[model samples]
Target: MTTWKDFLVSASTDAEAQFDRLKNRLFSRLDAKKPYKIVYYRGFGSPTAVWITGRVLRERDLSTPSDNDTFWQNLLATYQRFESDEVPGVTVRVDAFGKSNTAVTDKEGYFEMTINPPDNLPPGRAWFPVRYSLDAIVQPTGEPVIKDGYLMISPLYSQFGIISDIDDTVLVTGATSLLQTARLTFLGNAYTRLPFAGVAAFYRALQSGPVTTLFNPIYFVSSSPWNLYDLLIDFFRIQGIPKGPILLRDLSFSPAILSSQSHHTHKLAMIRKVLDVNPQLPFVLIGDSGQQDPEIYTQVVRENPGRIRAIYIRDVSEDRRDEDVRELIRTAEAFDVPMLLVPDTVEAAEHAASLGLIDPDTIPEIRADRRADKE
Candidate 1:
């Protein structure tokens, strides 16, 4: 049991320490002439923890803050909710890298932080956590005020990339069933998302590896609608998935366009955009076998050859016949790119780590099912 003063005092102290740690971390990693911005997000629900996630942008060449045209802004409005007794406030602690700083949300549930580049701040990736408390009090129920959560800010480059898929890949909204899909698209909210088990653990494992590594440039290229971006982000945060750019398709596209266009093509286009900007680095691709991932990956392997080092496909429906699976196997063999088919992301990651793609001692086990061939 904790009192109001106990909550306030503890929260304030923690917030201050978190702020200072973030400020110092950023200052140590930024250059004086480079500008950057931080975006904060808060989740709403019963005793839900609020999180701040943002990327830092820096100019390649030394540019004054006044001359720098690019700055950070929210793609969607920040969200907040007040129970009968919750209160919110935000404070911007420092400003460098253009609009880099800290801010607390007001009663309306909005907050912004800006910063200017510091001369001593080095030129590399940097991150900081925004910690705070929510204050609430219940009358007869005796519920206390002030819940605690965090906001995370780290530097990101436009050249960084990510590749993901729809259906059973990112969100488990039932891509195979039209009725289920309609329900998910129409009535579903963030809570409706059912992330494949072990996805969060796998993502965190990948992020924990070496800096500026091969898979650093990441993105989520899904056939799912852009409308679900917020939901997906919240899902990833709750599940502890690494944050990066997310590319979503238009759910309202023309029938001809939607039918004629392969999701693989859209994903390839996104990958091309990332490669066009950063031509030197390879990419990481993640997808599922519920639809046309095998066909798409086959084409990608043929076109790019060695651009993709590894490909992981979740085996959801198990609809691919023996011949089709064999063909995909041959395609992967031709390029020397390791293509994995796993029951879920966990098993896929286990294969990846075993192949030295990630560093984790304990790997998830794949359940073996013994069945005789009838034919």
Candidate 2:
């Protein structure tokens, strides 16, 4: 059942991996030896299972962001992120929940693994910390690289989960416009980039849910490349947005990349993975209408009936796209999932409040934050 497109994609992936191998070998001989590090990404799961992901790369001496950073400095830092030297074919290990599991980095130096949840984890606690280290040694070896990665664990008694998009939904990337997107991607750092007005308060409210202690886990599923993962994490930290596992796509170049299905494929796969891990959790999906969020979310609702409590699609597209989103809203409604096209975070918060998904008292805080962001 393999088509020509599939063949091309496989061929391109193999070719890219081969090229990376050769490049890594050549660089190792020419450049000075550098220490390797394991950059553990945040993970999430329920009480029975947990998922973790991270990358292994040569430690680069990039400049950290500062409040008074210059444009050139930000641009330089952004450039360095994309130019990261990945250490492929390296084994990674995670020791958590009284279990040990190992995985190897692929051509892109990324590794993902699923491990069992802690045996005696408390019921009310949300975050679980685990130790991860390099299982196998590779290149300029020094001391062993061991780091701690935290996973967001949802309690069985918690409220609905929040699955959100990053670029347009939370951060203002101007994703619909290529020029603006490129400008921000290249010239912007964590300090320079801006989140949408009231996004912080609204997301916090969703994380808090109806009950203050519910602590519903929020997962950020974005179509952005993994190279910008650190940058996005910095943005979340700075904007006071709730922190959770950020599932992002690999920056791969293939014949399939030319097709629009790539975005849908990546986003859908991540969302489904999240839903699968937390089987008992119902979710509220939040995204923007700039691209394929509406369509993809509709598919999610259709496939996982009753699992999605509601959906909020922020209006970031032209008037023409309005009808498309409205159609999706109707489609989602057929499954009893309330999908709303919101003008801003306030409206979405209002809708969530009415649904009892979030605290009604948080509306005033969202409005205040919106005004402050505008000013």
- What total of clashing residue pairs does each candidate reach? 38, 0
Q: Over the full model, what C-alpha lDDT does candidate 1 score relative to the true structure?
A: 0.49
lDDT on C-alpha atoms for all candidate structures: 0.49, 0.87
User: Could you give candidate 1's per-residue lDDT for residues 17-53 as a string of tens digits?
Assistant: 5754565467446544333222323311011111232
Leading candidate by lDDT? 2
Taking all chains together, the TM-score of candidate 1 against the true structure is 0.54
For TM-score, the strongest prediction is: 2
For 6-46, candidate 2 gives per-residue lDDT tens digits of 78788887888788778888878876477776788898888
lDDT agreement of model 2 with the native? 0.87
